[model samples]
Target: MSSINGKTIWVTGASSGIGKSLALKLSSYQCNLILSSRNKEELLKVKELCGGSNTISILPLDLTNHHQMEEIAEKAISKFGSVDMLVNNAGISQRSLIIETKVEVYEQLMQINYLGTVALSKAILPHFIANKSGHYVTVTSLMGKFGSPYRSGYCGAKHALHGFFDVMRMEHEKDGVKVTLVCPGFVQTNVAKNALTADGSPQKDDDVATQNGITPELAAKKMISAIEKGKFEVYIGGKEVKGIYLKRFFPKLLHKVVLKSHVR
Candidate 1:
């Protein structure tokens, strides 16, 4: 994990947002990249932006389709020889209250955000174990640690990733495999517009907070650097994520301040 140059990295959700930015950044390092997402046309655009046409390949994939996950792993191996890293970046966000959210909506969020990630990781584990070296980098969210209004399901799925991947890291540490869980508070991405509502409909509108967040390109640069260093868990954001720590250590005062803040 010390270097990415020439390493075969399979990046899921590479069509846009943080994934696209990461692919573009990693391409500059001359890493052999295998990009996957559901949108073939968008993936092509991302490949173009990454530069070095020969260094990147697009494999359109839907992470929610568990049956096709094994096929993706096989094709990735075939295209790149063997994957040195798997960036589990494909996920959907939910923006709904627990009571108002439909059961199926929560289920779908879990399938895409947590189960799909685990499925792909399980599919790639054998190869890494056999090779005795690999890295798994996941882009989780600030909601993973802090519960917020209208995001219960999203929080649940993101929290699940940390639980699952933390154990995966411990179990495979001796095998030379590394897992890094990245938590970004909010970034300038289309995630808010596409986020699921109570009935599984898209949010369709951007929030003021999300629109004013950090750029994806900047977030991507920091994430890639963290992956290269093999860090276990890192938080990225302006100051909202840091407030979670304060809320933990100073409950009464933080609770009073939070009650007056504009979280909704």
Candidate 2:
């Protein structure tokens, strides 16, 4: 394994799910960690679970507040003088149908999933350029690569991330700034349960495919492996990972298969 001892890492959405798992696993590596989310209480809990070591600090953040990203990034850099890597894992899920979903739902999805991520990344870009090296590991879904029945808005936002990050990689390669897009197919998390519904309220329900998917720990492991290897992109999960290849080579077939499966 690549050594990260003494390096500083920053992770968003670290209060729960894959982010939380990554924090727990990274704690063993003896690296400085900065955890961010909208929930300070849960972040503190996660820090304690990671042995409450002095290497970890919690910084609460709400992605929807795009204007504050620059300031937050400044504070994050102050944590350990410099951050070697950043894991962009904070995002929301959607479960509403295209026709039934409200316009506000789409707007909210873009604000958080696409624009918010972009803002924070840009806030940290200058630092990476000045340092001559940094890594951005963003967790977008397989839905970012293809469309699904109930995730119209979600797919749109995720797709936007790919477009922006691809260009970032191209423009910043000379600066030693690396980008890794993590496309997770599914994982047993609260994503499905907390997905926004047609009226913009939480689904408060579970999805079969998501419930039976890999554990968050396993997903976190795969994500970190991709980051360590500096992979441009990595897909994780069960059979759903094939959707990426299918969409690339057989668009029509992927469409048929998706409709037939009724995934939600």
Worst 10 residues of 1 by lDDT: 255-264
TM-score against truth, every candidate: 0.95, 0.98
lDDT by candidate, in order shown: 0.87, 0.93
User: Predicted candidate 2: what Cα RMSD to the true structure?
Assistant: 0.8
Steric clash count of candidate 1: 0
Stretch of 10 with least lDDT, candidate 2: 1-10
Candidate 2 residue-wise lDDT, 32-116, digit = tens: 9999999999999999999998899998999999999999999999988998888999999999888899999999999999999
lDDT string, candidate 1, 149-211, tens digits: 788888899999999999999999999999999999889999989999999999898888888
Q: Which candidate gets the maximum lDDT versus the true structure?
A: 2
> Which pairs clash inside model 2?
none
Against the true structure, candidate 1 reaches a TM-score of: 0.95
Query: 29 in model 1: Cα distance from truth in Å?
Result: 0.6
